[model samples]
Target: MKRYGHGLVLGKFYPPHAGHHHLVRTAADRCERLTVLVCAASVESLSLEDRVAWMREVHPGVRVVGTVDDIPVDVNDPAVWDAHMAVFRAAVPGRVDAVFTSEAYGEELGRRFGAESVCVDPGRSVFPVSGTAVRKDPVGCWDFLEPPVRAALARRVVVLGAESTGTTTMAWALAEHYRRRGGVWARTRYVPEYGREFSEHKLTALRTLHPGASWEEVTFASKEFPLIARRQAQLEEEAARAGSPVVFCDTDAFATTIWHERYMGGLYPAAHEPRRQHLWLLTDHTGVGFEDDGLRDGEHLRPWMTGRFREELARTGRRTVELTGPHERRLATAVAAVDALIGEGWDLADPLPETP
Candidate 1:
């Protein structure tokens, strides 16, 4: 088997760390020569010249080249990128055999063209990131990203709901409460759960009828669906492990499941008697303001549906905690509940005794 990459393995070796170092060392061992391409030179943000300088300092004899002035910097204007690459490759008479990359599509693109692409994975499973524990705070993206990309996610939280229901107002109040209590708040990004995006799509899209399909067919399809149904326990576990003292999840996963069935006509069991355990019913939405998200069937549907959300929760055989009262009262109630749980030493580790 005559493998072409006994020669150069190429990549944009940006700020080479343990991962990059691992990839380059592995590639260098397998191949006779390696061409680390410093692409996106003219595009700014850590110039190609600087990258080459860093690589030269570290890699010593390893060959690296800059394509700053050579290639079309405007990749967003995709029409010119391919043409630009061709001219750039032609212009750089300096040799290269393959494009060395870790990204999946990058490998495919290289294979399609004349060049070969190498997948130099860092074996992420073994050496979990040093930055991971920091990410649990739900604050800075520093925990989620490498240094360069970490700076991109500067954020602020906005809350929304009905006027007296205290959406934006509660947001500020909570921020203050968290600050005074010496608590690190997971800034809440809440909006009315009217689910506008889903609503708009439903207007034209044919609604899957309730009377039409058998339970088995719908249940089977939902089970086989690619996106895994995220369990509530998993979320709780993450919040705890992240060491976040108080997690303010907007409507929880149970709420999500109920809403899916209620609004979008999502899957629900035909027989309600054999109920799932460890669920909460939406009860006492007496003061809850009902707002229309354009595609809402009408105002009348709100009251009927509000009651049903709770009934369905009870049907699941899950314990119900009905959130009630005015804006200040409800917000205070929620805070009180979290404080009470923390006081009682609510161990999130305990699995919901039964599934809802």
Candidate 2:
């Protein structure tokens, strides 16, 4: 380790994983004080504040600054080089003696800043990690992240929509498709459908009770999304316990809110707001057709609800990979995609890997 003034790290820290922590800890130990810049949450990665909090926890006495409102700098894009450079300068007040990094970009950043550099090289030998790899196969990549993160991601994906639109059909098709193929990571757990569980529960519970019958009940029903969000967290914990990777829920907490609002004309935007980041798996409704299952509110209303779903998704600005084709086709497409990801070296042994 070469001596330097202060050690600084430049990264979005989207969700500080172990790899990041290792780098930071190393830098903090070498330099007198460590300064970390938290990237803006609205950037492409769109981080939640958890990463920043984790960094704080690690270096309780370290210097911290945040660029919550600044535009995120993607160093990859030469266009933002000057802009992000300017932001970087602004993030840390005047001259620092040194910058620390584990990635090549750190060297480049150090050169740009005219600062001495200390590098912490953590390649394959250090840890086979990255949040991107972990997210792609949370269950398989569980060991890469912290236990808390793993527990938060083992959720169940439930796909739902108006009757005949292929919710149950897609669910069962996907479940069977994945199961027959041995599923990802050689894990032997069945993908459960929310509707099946809901229906079964209804068969036994409806005989004794109804789905909360007041307008308030309907409004409350509209609020089931929060329950879904809560369940997302709960299920993540369950998957961790079961040693499964993160759940690939077909539908999600927001979907629950969307359905309730449609059925009861009641609003509960809060439920979906927090889960917006989690609803990354949606299909474009541009060319999809609806089947008649009698559970659909109406055909005329199909476009309306679907439109609303898209609109809300747009509001969140998350990308969507429209699952096209018939229900069977969509299932085949989803399974193939997951398989491709696995083959590409997405981790399958862990769920939410500790900060990596």
Candidate 3:
């Protein structure tokens, strides 16, 4: 158990998983200070900044840095090795005491660095996973991924429409449907509309002042929509991190924008764009009747709201599935759409090849 003054742990870390963390931790434990160099190629799907950020968040105590290394890897080629070493050395100029790695190239890497090459779990016995396997099939390696990585990879599907159009019901049903698949799908999560919760709280506060304050009496300020949108985004992010490969939302920030327009009679300036939403399930109000659950008051405006949603969704170019018909039929259609989404695996580009 010889401790070193400075240690180095470098890798692509396309999406930092348990194995990468284990390697970093092991190196950190055996060294006074560790520098984790994350080398990403230009052709790769994941950005160097994101990979660096993920590593930094996961290994805060360790110094994490990133560099763009577009040079192809040919371990046996001295010229190619020299090119890579240049990139690695420039990124970690002060490193020297030890080089820690789990790959078979540890010996050569250590020799080039003029430091001891300590291999941690070279056989993949501990935390058996790799970036290659993860890129090919992220769902299969879901458990190995960290929260940040999972959040980034999760396919967020938003179920939204006019009030009482079964958006909440559909979201819940979809989550349960995925949970039935077992394994990682058992942890599938459904995010509730934060706007509804906000509305409920607002009504409660109003009633405290006026003993008989009704739902209609509870009004929304233009400023409140931004807050609601931010909270909705936060809740969706949290659910995506903890849940399965896909997360269902009963109404996301995008829907909040529409609600803001419906109530405030103008577009919200700070409406959050649904950047992470992979698909939208727009529940049509044709077959579903509006139920006044004390929080809803737009029964007559259902048609207008539904039409607006359709127009906005189309305008935004969002991938959407309009759910119509009976509850059972809608659920079945929703399930098929979700299954197809999941089937379209994460299209993470392959990294630079390393010669055997």
Candidate 4:
């Protein structure tokens, strides 16, 4: 139990998990100061900046830095080891009292750094997880991941369309369907349409002065779309962080762009941003009656809005499925699409091989 003045913990940390956090915590506890170097390759799916940000958020006390290390890992080859050491030394560049790791190569890594080798959970019995396992099956290893990692990996499915096309109902039903699967899926969440809420507030405020103002009287300024879009994005992000492997959104920021076009008669670039949704389920207005809920005055414009949504979704190259027919039928189609998406799985590329 010898404490070191400066300890080093380096890894690809493609996506930091509970096991990686445990190793860092153990190293931090034993060392006066710890430096966690995250080495990522250019071909990796996750960005070096994102991995560094995650590590810094998780272990704020430890100095977390990231560098691109494209050198292939061959632990037994001295030449490969020297090449890697060069990259590591350049990133650290300071005295290293110890090298902490959970792999068998700790001894050589420490020797190269001219410091003690401290191995934590070399057998993988403590956390029982690895970066490869997590990448291969993120849903199965969901519990081993942190909120930020979960948010990044979650398959965000957005259900959106014109006013009163069963978007809200389908979003809730999809969430419930997933929740029935139990385990991590039991925590499946649905993000409501923030634009509708904003409209309600605006209508309510307008009524306070006139006391008899209707939805038609409540006008929307072009500037309001951006605020609503931002709030919708924020809500989706929060739900994705806390929900299950997939999150169902009644409407998302992408939908806001279309809504802006509908209301403002033109595209508002400020109201839209590139979203990371895996799939978009557009609830078709066909055979679905529009019900005005005191805040909706676009019943007549449903068809136009639906067409606009279709045009935008297609032009943007977003993967989308139009839900038609009865509620039960639409729900069934949506469920199948979501199941297929989940079955496809996260295709995270494997990191550089490290031979023991």
TM-score of each: 0.35, 0.47, 0.98, 0.98
Runs in model 3 with CA error above 4 Å? none
Candidate numbers sorted by TM-score from highest down: 3, 4, 2, 1
lDDT digits (tens) for residues 239-334 of candidate 1: 333423333333343444444454346664322221212222132436666554343333555555566665755575554555567666656665
Q: Which has the higher lDDT value, candidate number 2 or candidate number 4?
A: 4
Local accuracy of candidate 3 as per-residue lDDT tens digits, 1-356:
89999999999998789999999999999999999999999999989998999998888999999999999988889999899999999988975899999988899999999999999999889998999899999999999999899999999999999999999999999999999999999999999999989999999999999989899998889999989999999999999989999999999888888898899999886836558899999999997877999998999989999999999999989999999999999999999999999899999999988787
Tens digit of per-residue lDDT, candidate 4, span 1-356:
78999999999997899989999999999999999999999878999999999899889999999999999899889999999999999999999999999988899999999999999998889899999999998998999998888889999999999998889999999999999999999999999989989988998898899899989888888899889988888899899999999999999988888888888898786825667799999999989987978877888899999998899899999999999999989998999999899999888888877776
Residue pairs in clash, model 4: none
Worst 10 residues of 2 by lDDT: 347-356
**What CA RMSD would candidate 3 show?**
1.1
lDDT of 2 by residue, 1-356 (tens): 46556878867655456777777777777777789887654533424465566567666778867775355445576656676677788878778878887776776688777887677764734767775665555555555656445434443344545434555556556555555555443342333435334534444454456654322222224444555556654543454445344245556555666666666687775634354223233554445665543223355666677667777767867544446666567777666655554355422232222222
Report the Cα RMSD per candidate: 18.7, 9.9, 1.1, 1.1
Tell me model 3's lDDT, rounded to 2 decimals. Answer: 0.92
Compute the lDDT of residue 97 as modeled in candidate 2.
Answer: 77
Candidate 1, clashing residue pairs? 279-318, 282-310
Worst 10 residues of 1 by lDDT: 346-355
- What is the model-wide C-alpha lDDT for candidate 1? 0.43
Prediction-by-prediction clash tally: 2, 32, 0, 0
